[model samples]
Target chain A: EAGVAQSPRYKIIEKRQSVAFWCNPISGHATLYWYQQILGQGPKLLIQFQNNGVVDDSQLPKDRFSAERLKGVDSTLKIQPAKLEDSAVYLCASSGEGSGNTIYFGEGSWLTVV
Target chain B: SQKIEQNSEALNIQEGKTATLTCNYTNYSPAYLQWYRQDPGRGPVFLLLIRENEKEKRKERLKVTFDTTLKQSLFHITASQPADSATYLCALGLDRGSTLGRLYFGRGTQLTVWP
Candidate 1:
């Protein structure tokens, strides 16, 4: 079976510019997630979607970051007015319905903000 | 505040030897824990999961032990190979009386196996 798919494997933008990342999860997966991984750090959960509805986004930066999963199959994460700290890898992952379900991740979209 | 911590330093081991990694957490009682393997510039791949009720789980040459009393998880890779060189992350799953819960991850332990 195919794993999670992500687009624009790498991206570069200037500070204060805007950037977006797209993700297509595995077939039949019910849960999708977006995570940000800074260099030398673990992936931090940014948002989670369960079939077109948000499950959790408490850690999301409301002022600068937003994400949506309209159809429950695909998702997009956007960051506006990017800052130098926003330079990190955006990872998209998908899982089944249970907490014990294994999460599969994409190669991730690398962003470099100047 | 809840915190999950793994050794930030890299671990170096010779091939054919056993490699051990530790994950420690504070201020949280997780229902389950998971281990993931990550390569440079790539996302993490799920390796194993152990429940709080279970003390140990194994897959192939990998073994994971969860100690709730100590709030720690130990990951062991047996007969390690050079190919096993990568970062290993430990995540804790918080159960909110539902099938889904949030996962808090550690900074990960980098393991380097040399031939």
Candidate 2:
């Protein structure tokens, strides 16, 4: 019954600093996803992992953003040399492998770059 | 490029009235669509899902209608209440034969119900 869990609910960093966010998906969920949500905007997916292997990462900024779900139960998203534009909420979500399964989201990690 | 569009403006309606929100997409076809509710400072919560072949879906007070030809999905809340006020998001599921977990999101439409 527990939902997805994220760490460091709020973060503040200067431009060019590096930030990392951690997420633990719901129990028994095999698919995990990372999404970014800017103010006044909807959440955009950054990457997806299916049991420790990446399913999709086409939208991830390879040069700056990196994510891994080595064991498949949890995930970490890192942003290096963060920019002002990186100020947004980092959301972690998960779902079962079956079709039509509902995706559950965490409380989100809020990042602010000044 | 693929794009999803939702009303950027906030919708204000009476608490007893029905609230209707629109979501439109262009440049790509999805096999299914989903609606989510997002409160301030919280992540999105799934509300409903409707596949391309389906015309309408309902969950309690929530209803969703999808039109593949029009590339549009409509979400309605009947007998709305102040507690139902929040930003609503529409996400496009993967195209047929692709992975089903991936989704693309819109900017979301904010709704406020007044007493």
Best by DockQ: 2
Q: On residues A1-114, what C-alpha lDDT tens digit does candidate 1 reach at each position?
A: 888999999999999999999999988888899999999888899999989999999999989999999988999999998999999999999888542568889999999999
Best by lDDT: 1
- A23-114: candidate 2 lDDT, tens digit per residue: 99988888899999999888888999988999889999999999999887889999999999999999999988553548899999999999
Worst 10 residues of 2 chain A by lDDT: A94-103
Cα displacement (angstroms), candidate 2, residue A91, comes to 0.5
- Distance from true location, Cα of A114 in model 2, Å: 0.8
- In candidate 1, how many Å is residue A45 off? 0.5
What clash pairs does model 1 have?
none
Candidate 2: Cα lDDT at B24: 90
Segments of candidate 1 deviating more than 4 angstroms: A97-100, B96-98
Q: Evaluate all candidate structures by whole-model CA lDDT and list the values in order.
A: 0.92, 0.91
Docking class of 1: medium
Best by TM-score: 1
Worst 10 residues of 1 chain B by lDDT: B94-103
